[model samples]
Target: MQQACTGDRFFTFYLLDGFALHGFSAAVEALRLANDVAGRPVYDWLAVTADGQPAVSSCGMRIAADRSLAEERDRLLRVAPPRCIVVCGGRMAPPPDRALEAWLRLCGRNRLALGSFASGLYPLARAGLTDGRRCAVHWEHFPDFSERFFTAKARQTAFEIDGSLYTCAGGNAPFDLFLRLIEADLGTDTVNRICEIALRERLRETGERQRLPLQARLGTDNAFLIRVIEQMEANLSEPLRLTALSPASGLSRRQMERLFRREMGRTPARYYLDLRLERAHLLLLTASQPIIEIAMACGFSTASHFSRTYRERYGCTPQQTRLAETARRRAGGRGNAPEMEHERHVA
Candidate 1:
């Protein structure tokens, strides 16, 4: 029986339509690296869709799968049940197939581990798998996920691994999650080897932040300044004036000004303008909007003002930044290309 078996650990990747292409790709590539570096196949990955059809990603790319859920059920019965199942996709709930849910329930009962990436948390929540377990979700979707499922403990972290439930913040965190998994199941030596082949910097430990660092995020150290920065980020498309933020934060304008100068090393108005410029930079890269449109969207009074400030902070005009990002995305690939390379270098 042992001789007939092909590999030890079966990793079933459930590819839901509108799955995040980057998240799934990062996971598969990480596993591939682990296998190659280990000098033996430690994991066997099989992509599966509901009806054995190919799956499409939210980014409009299509990927073929190895089997259907039904066929997988038969295979599981014949061999060892899958040791791990990874759900990958967007905001949609898990397919409302009762049989599939039942299969997962049985797998869980039998001690199989499970994980979800990005908005894939929706289905896991829908299947009642995350109830009572702490899960990490993409920050953008946390509000909606929390509202929809009150039974689970969801947070904006890089990843959460509680017992058999593993959830990662979407985007690049899958690489970290899979690397951590390799280190947990195989060994640290294997993870380091995989990292070398994948060209990834050392796998970010779970202790590292899932988001930008606090100092970089706020661009300052003052508590009040940080709060104002948070407020600006919370309302990027619709920014607030110094006067408005002062009243909202219960600080007089003079006090706010003093706090900003002491902590952020800049006036509130300048800080807020930089924030707007940052938003404009992101829009310019990801959206195909005109510079004027982006300027207006980010609350610039006029395109000329937006362009001047953008150039000062970014060392290039908004159009130039967008062009550079576009070129990088084309050369490498969509998704993993650094979103704030220009600004990071400038700052």
Candidate 2:
């Protein structure tokens, strides 16, 4: 153990019930490693919960808290507050606690820096701290988060740092976020040492991709096929005819169809139809647009046609899908039900 640095920073991690273990561990471990390598306590931290008791993680592991939100609130005017406060979020977090929301608002009024790990953005957004700010959440939660909180800009990147707000897509991404903070506070040399000790090959910068690329995901290097898919994705509202795509792809219509069959295991037209349907499905779940407007946005000739095709593909009508999503939300399930059909057309 090393002595404390003159300018030691204090961090408080508020563990919501069922918090993500990987994100919490990654963040705390990064700070711990920084202290070990610096030969001084450059950072100090304490785990906190809503009540003065241990909180269970999503994986069923438990972490004891040093204090409760009530205790901290009572001492708010007496002791200096931590420099940063982080909320550890998970899939199974219970309904938003009003007490927690109030505390977050108090933190915001004090102008203290705040952060969220994984799905913690939900609570932060509910507390109105993330309004109009870009934040990162796990990709699985992106659609639901966007639908619920229209004011916050939900990005799909690995992490985001907008002034006093910090957010990271949960998992190992927090390690990268903590490294960035360490670099800013201590320097690149200390960050490098921490990364080396943690066996991290490289530090992913903010705004870098969190998900795999299309080519890597599909295990193919077909440039023409990739370009055609890109075109389909870009022209969702105005689908291009095969003839129009042929000239752009440098392949004749027949050649493109044959290539789509070989690479995607489906004909070009069928693949394109599935692509549009997937976009429509996402819009139905995440946007409040009317069904007819969604149909037009997805290039459907009419709302009935869109609903018919959606039923055939998803085993439910578009209205039904929307209803199911609403029911799931009302029931407190934060994620969409698994798609009945595997999305083979996703680029």
Candidate 3:
């Protein structure tokens, strides 16, 4: 239905148990700034939760909602409903939550816009909101998401908007998405003024790439190690064997191990194992693949061996790790899981 008026666009951000504080704050601040810049409320926004309780964020912060899911529905209906609803901060592979699923179905029927931040896209995908729509998701989760939902076009964009659906890569993309919203509804001038007030850099256009180049993040001068790690990362599924890596750099396997340890402080095998694990971890979180399937993709010959190695490295079995990840998100903690830190961040 067409809006009865074209005044303030209403937005409701639904917070699952464990949402990211940074992403949520970014969305709120962007809207706040846009409203300030416009010299009027361009957006009428509200944060809501399942039970009218405080939802904890991944950054150890808690947000008190304006209303519970039930109470907010009436106001949401009255306030032009939601032109768009962005869901952020939750487990990537959440099992069916009937109440939450029902609400999303209603939104789908009403054509209220939909979106997600970071791994939050998992639930939306599970709820079947993203079918037949191009979506954007954080790059870390891209592999499993691609492998499972082969048909969905998942881009490495800061954000993607396909008709009423909107998605922003988690981290800082929320800032960009809201700025775009401001520019779309209010004007560009309002967005600029808010950017100035917030002391933030000007928003990157939607087409700009989301993540910085790897060499920059690593802060490394060792060209060889960087090259080798890059190759390993790019081929996690069909990773180069130790013998294969030898020829890639014209170095003996022993020489490669020595170089990796000298520069990266880990053996080549350990580093490679970690790389595969990181990819597996992301897929486990974002895609609905069975553990066996994910294990095979990450180069594990058997699920048992994969579980054992994952436990040894991550201090938890693969199933334990997955469960902990899901629980942490549900508990609203932004706990860091094992990532393929090809550089200094990997342990």
Candidates in order, TM-scores: namely 0.66, 0.73, 0.79
Candidate 2, residues 1-347, lDDT tens digits: the string is 11122337878888887688899889888988988898977788777788767776665556777778888777666777788899998653246779988998999999989999877787799899989998986765665576578899889899999999999988889999989998998899999888889888999988888888878966888999988888987787789998899989999999998999999999988999998898788767655667987798788988888988899999999999989866754543434333221111100
Identify the leading candidate in terms of lDDT. 2
Model 3, span 1-347: residue lDDT tens: 01122336767777876577778778877876676666675666667788876676655566767667777666656655777877876435445577776778788888888888877676677778887777886777777676766667788888887877888877877888888877887777777788889887777876567777767766676777777888888788787888877777777888898998887789988899998988777776665678999999988889998888887877877777777766765544545543221111100
- Which ten residues in a row are the worst by lDDT in model 1? 338-347
Query: What lDDT would each prediction earn against the true structure?
Result: 0.73, 0.80, 0.73
Q: What tens digits encode model 1's per-residue C-alpha lDDT throughout 2-106?
A: 112245576788877667878888887887777777777777677778887667666556676677888877787787777688888653333356766776776
**Residue pairs in collision within model 1:** none
What is residue 271's positional error in candidate 1, in angstroms? Answer: 11
Model 3 misplacement above 4 A: 1-7, 67-79, 221-225, 242-262, 281-291, 319-347
- Residue 41 of model 1, lDDT score: 72
